[model samples]
Every structure is written in C-alpha cells, then in structure tokens.
Target: MGRIPCCEKDNVKRGQWTPEEDNKLSSYIAQHGTRNWRLIPKHAGLQRCGKSCRLRWTNYLRPDLKHGQFSDSEEHTIVKLHSVVGNRWSLIAAQLPGRTDNDVKNHWNTKLKKKLSGMGIDPVTHKPFSHLMAEIATTLAPPQVAHLAEAALGCFKDEMLHLLTKKRVNFQFQQSNVAPVNTTHDEKDDTVEIIKLNLSRAIQEPDMLPSSKPWDFTGATSANFAGACNAFPGSITGFQYGPSSFGNEGAKSPWSQSMCTGSTCTAGEQQGRLQEKLEDENGGESEGGKEIRNGSSIFNTDCVLWDLPSDDLMNPIV
Candidate 1:
C-alpha cells in the first residue's frame, strides 16, 4: 500500500504562514503545550495541517532558535559531527544550541563543503585525496598468488604507494641531510623507477611492507582450512581473532590442526575421530565451543592450519 499523506483535505492552507496565523498557533501551544500534533490544528483553530504546523514551530518559530551566522566553534562542531555521523542532520543540529536540522544542512551544502575541498580533503570520506585513493586501490585489488609453493600474502596498495611517495617527499628534507635532486631529472621517470623497484621487492620481502597483516589471503580459503568455530584463518581456534595475530606473542606448540595423533588413519577417518573427540570434550558444542573440557579453547575446536612456506604471497599493484 502507498504511504498515507499526512493530510488530505483540499481546504487546508499551504505555504507562507502570516503573523496572525503564527500568533494563533503559538498562543494555543503556550497554553496547552504540544502533545498530539494531529489534534493541534483542530484545537488551535489554524488553517494548516498538523505536520505543517509542527515544522513551522520546530524549524522556525521555536522560542530557543538561534539566528545569525554560525560561530567558528559551532562550525568546527558541525564538521567533527559530520565526519562521525555522515548526513544525520538532526543529530548534528541537536549538538548546537538554537540550530535546526534544516539550518545545519543548508550551511553544510553552501559553505562547509567548499571549505573542506579547498583544504585538499574529501568532504565525504574526510580523507586526503592521496590516502583515499590508496585505500580504494587496495580494497579493489584482485587476489594474486605469488607462487603455488608459498604461503599466500594479502597486499595493501596503500603501503606500496606510501613507500613510493615517501622516497619522493623526503629526498631533500633538512633532517635527512640528503642532497637535492638535480632539476634536470624528470620527476615522472623517478616515480616510475620506484614503482618498478618495489613491485618486485614486494614479492620477495613482503614483511617490509608497512602495516602488513600475516594471515590475510587473496582468495576464498579452502573448506579444509576453514575452522568450525570461525571462518577466518587468524583464529585457528575458531573462537576469536586469537590471542596474537602477528605471532609476536611467541609461538605455541603442536600448532598444526592435524587430527592425526600418532595412530595412522585415513584423512576422512582422522577428521571423524577429531570431530567425535571434540564433541565429547566440549559436551557437543563444537561450532563456537561452549566449554573447553581440556582447559584450552578452541581445541574443544578442531581445525586445520597448513604448515607453511607452501604459501603464496600477494600485494596490490595499484
């Protein structure tokens, strides 16, 4: 069904509330107070619908409404609020006294947008153009395996560009004490050289990539690798992201999730035995374990973590 209109009567007045009309609406509300907006028009004797009357009061005729230019502090508040809430105008307006959502929306459309753009920031994303593009590139980059024999690597385009650009920017800084670039050298050629140099280096020395995360892979992980407790490889236990993602917390032993326990068995047999063991240990809550019967999580969780170096590494190209 179509949405019901707030008002349907043709005789109801529309647009341009005159002083007498405003006076009548205000006087009635002052005495009885705003409760049911639908009944306000009838009680107040106004020629407008309840919805129109509500807007007329809240957006314009509110007693506490503040007029005049938005102060610098207020403008900063709007920008900060906007960065967090996006386009929730009513929320932004509530933070500043005497401002309506309409007022805040108009000011942002007319003024704040231009101001942010002039400062080289994206008014929507609130990031510098270079940084935004780098993030976009990374998310969009297709997963590529470095080699069938290597552990798969997850790449960030942001890191690659950051490394490339940092070299160009710091070449002549005072702290660096490096000699200035010869004016005759083309900047374009230098950038191309850096890209080519690092593109190959990324494959061989992925750890050198800034902010690299170890467990990120390029494609859909095989079902064999998928944990019963969690789909992500970061948590072999399958309960959470795990104690430490980087392995910097020191390695835990017998880490591979292989079900084989010295007694030789088929892969299928091993899996069945593992699942039965887990169900018995966890009292039948394996997929997101309930109780760790053996005083360790996740082992009440059975999963597979492949032994490495047979992993391929990949980073974004763009």
Candidate 2:
C-alpha cells in the first residue's frame, strides 16, 4: 500500500500567504462555515494545502479573531488555564474566545514559560521551584535525621542560655581605686578613694527568678538562631559544672551536677545546676571580694562576661 499526500507540493503555494489568498479564505469561511478543512483550500481557490488554509483562516483571517495585543485579563486566563490543563492548547483556546490553539501555544512557549520560570515557578508542574528542590533534597537525604540534629543543637543552646541567665552568676568586673587630690592649704584635707567597678551580667528574669518553661530560641528571627528550638535532647543524661581553675582564697565552689531522668530534663534542672555551681564557686567570696565567677574559673583575674539584654537574648538581633 502507498501513502496519499495531503496536497500537491508542485502546484501549492508556500511561505507567506498573499493578500488574495487571505481574502479567498476569509470570504469562503464567511459564506460557508468550515465543515471540512481538507476541502477548504480547493473550494476557496487557495493553492495552499488544506492544513495551511485552515491555519490561515483560524489564526489570521477569521473575522472574530482578536487582532491586537492580548489584554491583561486574557494573559492571566491563559496562564491559569495552562497551569490546570498543562500544554493542552486546544482545550485552553476553547475557553479563550477568538484565540486559536496555535496562537496560545506560541505565546506560552515564547513568553509565558519564561515569565513563570523567572518568578521561581515551574511552568510544567505549576509549583514553586524552591519547593520542588526541597522535595528533591529530602528524597535524596533523610530530612528527619537532619531535623533531629538541628533540634538537638537548638536544645543545647537554649539549655545553656537558660542556665546562664537563671543562676545570677556574678560576672567578672575591673576594679580601679582612684585617690583624691591632695590639698596644701592650712585647713585639713579629707581624701576619699573612689572604686570603679565595671560589671557585666545577663538580663534578670521578670520576678528575679528562673521561669519554669525552657528558654525558646525558635521564635528568634536572626539567621544565627533561625532553626533553634526548645526541643529537649533525649540522649543527654545530665550537665556538670566544674571549676576550671583554683581561686586565690583557696576556698572554691563545689562541683554541681543536675541529672535528667528518663528521656528529658526541664529548664528548672538546668537552672538548679547553674545555681549550685555559682553558689559553690562564689559562696565564700565577700561582697567586696576581688574574685567573681565568670561562668568558669579559667583566667581568674581576666575573665570577661558578655551580657545580653532580656529582649535581645530572647529575640536575637537579626
């Protein structure tokens, strides 16, 4: 068996359609509706193929066709419909009056696809590109494990901050004694020594006591604390605070440790450990004593304590 040709290539005119051909196609379609596209060209006196005649009439010469630029509403409709139907140009064109399937397909390929891609949306899937990438990443790796690890880190940070704030540990301070100027007059001179103390301490709690709830860093907006959470670690049994060095008084704070029972520990346990550590470390030191607990006994003289405001500590600086 032999295949039949759609049209005779030798006799059919190709390339751009002439004005006469356009007029023929328009007039024939106007007089008689397009029932059979294979017979349209022959009946309309067009030397082009039936397919060519149908395309010319539907895309260009149709009286109901929208000739000018597509309106914003029309463009939006095309995008929405394309998202739902996905490359079914004929179905999309049916909804858009006067728009041919060929025109819609061309617009989608040339402009709409690029626009959607620029907006971080996948034109084919109609989903956010970032979301798609996240799904792919999760599929490749175990997201649960990653989440658990991040939660553990966040819990550790929150625990540390809670302990530091609850204990009311006296931070290290620099003391300077300035002597008053001497007077050479006949009258007696009373000289007073001024002591300057630069103290650093974390913001105190509302009632000057630790809160029952754990300090939450999850609400923080800063990049440093973006993924921080209040989730307690299941593996950690307890926390121990030990003296890193010896004090000049020879009387040092006792080692304090708080044990976590079962799977988790509360913020109170952390605070208890901190309180015990601070008491043992600075219990013997007097108010005017030269030594202070700087969270650790290391560098007894030059320890520096960094203080954070209450609001700033809770909600980190972005």
Best by the TM-score measure: 1
Local distance difference test, each candidate: 0.46, 0.42
lDDT of 1 at 34: 88
Candidate 1 C-alpha lDDT tens digits along 56-103: 998888788988987654565566556545677876675566788899
Error of 2 at 123 (Å): 1.2
Model 2 lDDT at residue 246: 14
TM-score of 1: 0.44
Error of 2 at 109 (Å): 1.7
Clashes of each: 9, 2
Query: Which regions of candidate 2 deviate over 4 angstroms?
Result: 1-6, 142-318
lDDT of 2 by residue, 1-318 (tens): 775676787888888998887888888988888998877788888889888887887788888777676544445556654544467676656545677878899888987675544333456765433223333333434545345334433433333333223432221211212222223232111111010000000111112212222222123222211111101111011111112211122223221111111212123343333333333433435457443444633112221111222122122111
Clashing pairs in 1: 150-310, 150-311, 150-312, 151-311, 151-312, 152-312, 153-313, 155-315, 298-301
Q: What is candidate 2's CA lDDT for residue 186?
A: 20
